[model samples]
Target: MSTTTSPSKHLLELQGVHTHIGAYHILHGVDLVVPRGELTLLLGRNGAGKTTTLRTIMGLWQASQGSLRFDGRDISRLHTPQIAGLNIAYVPENMGIFADLTVKENMLLAARQARTVAQIDEARLQWIFGLFPAVQKFWNHPAGKLSGGQKQMLAVSRAIVEPRQLLIIDEPSKGLAPVMINNMIDAFAQLKASGVTILLVEQNIHFAKRLGDSVAVMDNGRVVHAGRMAELAADEALQRSLLGLAL
Candidate 1:
């Protein structure tokens, strides 16, 4: 007799997603699933459409085909803000900080958009500060003045200020020093420990191998391999074929 496995505990799923940027079609048909309380990493070489997949999921760009399901409900074509309102947060590569605004102000902007903003609670703010003390220290400084790592922290903090079902992040370690990357990884780990589901698009294989609960490898806009993190890390030849990297 065979036992059937249950659906994921968390609430994010992408099925046969196809996306196009301008005249170019990037994701021919991609499928992704992220369980709650797990860190799911999407990995690929440059131009593999890793970031584009995140955009399509966030509804920044409409999907020409397939379904995006959150909490077992279909949300394939919802507006961007609408998707955000459903407790899914997105932090893109640029970090989207307000250059002229102070660190506190940028957070405040995100706070106001949250359902609990009217209450002005500091619990989440305090938690954010605890996760990234640098933000607390730079509260009064313009967000533009922060280092690359600090800005990435601020972006992530802002995205998660609200209670979210899914947090989608793009290239959190991109363009950061070794120390900053470590800091970001620690932050992500902390987030995972809190039982928040994360779907990340990352290029750093080492980082992905360390934090990813499951790995999805993409190539030419298609996901070529999906498996356990340890399986990929242990196979050298698979790494070369999928990522063009020996390690």
Candidate 2:
């Protein structure tokens, strides 16, 4: 495990977050922080409540207790659009792309909402095309015509069009072919290098192992383990116990 410093340098802080989904209580005083300019992975088995945590951070679900702060501002009571206006982009597991829209059309719409997006628009499209060349090859193609992995890439690329301060992505690799999965990892690494703060929720341990810088493991709605991704990879016991993987 890597050595720890204090969390005072964090850009996003969630202190003792308590959230409920419908009648079900999910988060039990959850605490998390996303340091500025760093990639953080949220990992766990199914039903561990990682999705809810992301929603809470995005203000989709308000915490019954605790506070969420972004860049030293209290946002626990902010609306979803308010948080989004702050440049925190979220790509849900569904990819959320309009299937009928073409890649060019999607980028066009995104560009209209964000003017500075031009830089990211130029950089992100080029980078994504490089990461998954299929995108460039199919620029005018409708999103619905693409495969699962291609759709996933488009979703991420769509989010990156605006160059947000933070990106929270859920299950970017769900139902993807092995080749596409590898390609996605490379793309994520490129985004990190380009200065994107990422909070990713992933179930595929191998994918997380390849892309994650730091890993936080959640179980039963609470974080139970956190450390450098290297440490998580080396500890077979931790993997088997926390993730039920046959390490």
Candidate 3:
């Protein structure tokens, strides 16, 4: 039940990418593909280099070898700001919220094009509010005061504060309750409907199964499996073999 997507249709591609952090080599010739306008899940067990892969894509970590392409253009040597300027937004697992800033201020800061809340697109703001009501609820509250789940929502809200070509999020469902996870799922569903390509690093299989259109499972810094989400979701043995857990 595996599925394949043409390279031309892929918004992001990595071929033989390798990353080293001082004395440690993280990504070992990793190859990954993310199709346009679909959610692709990057799944792996702990210490499998999932976060390292994301950081490499963001130019937060320079690849020592291999090529990285976005929209068919070479971006392997770009700096973080340059990479971000290409309309790719990244939300790290730490959530990256400014604790002392108000929720509205955080959103405003992420919107580089907008200097004021009034400058933000009214309709888009409303859409984001619909996606995560907590953002709207805590608009004036300090981000540090929010609960874990609420802060995660704010982080996502900040990333989407303005439109972008791609959204790379690390574990949006991490540390969330079942009810909160459902809310996060719904928000992502709406985001997908908006036709934005997403690359998510998720350890939550339930979250991945529910929203992932394509999946690439990593181990020891390389992609060991790639296919349609439904295919992996339907095969319990494949799940166990690749992820070391049943879906």
Highest-TM-score candidate: 3
Tens digits of per-residue lDDT for model 3 on 81-111? 9999999999999999999999999999998
**lDDT winner among the candidates?**
3
**lDDT (tens digit, per residue) of candidate 2 on 65-145:** 999899888999999989988988889988888889897676666654554434445665676678778767778899899
lDDT of 1 by residue, 1-247 (tens): 9999676674787888899878989998998878778999999888998899999988899999888899877889789988888888899998888989998788888875555344546787788888889988998899999988889999998888777778999999989898888888888898999988999988777688879998888888888898877888899999999888876
Query: Candidate 2 at 76: error in angstroms?
Result: 0.8
Instruction: Give Cα distance to truth, residue 147, candidate 3, Å.
Output: 0.6
* Candidate 3, superposed: residue stretches over 4 Å from native: 1-7
Please tell me which model should have the higher TM-score, number 1 or number 2.
Answer: 1
**What are the models' TM-scores?**
0.92, 0.90, 0.96
* Model 2: pairs clashing at backbone N, Cα or C within 3 Å: none
lDDT of candidate 2 vs native? 0.83
Clashing pairs in 1: 10-36
Stretches off by above 4 angstroms in model 2 are 1-8, 112-124
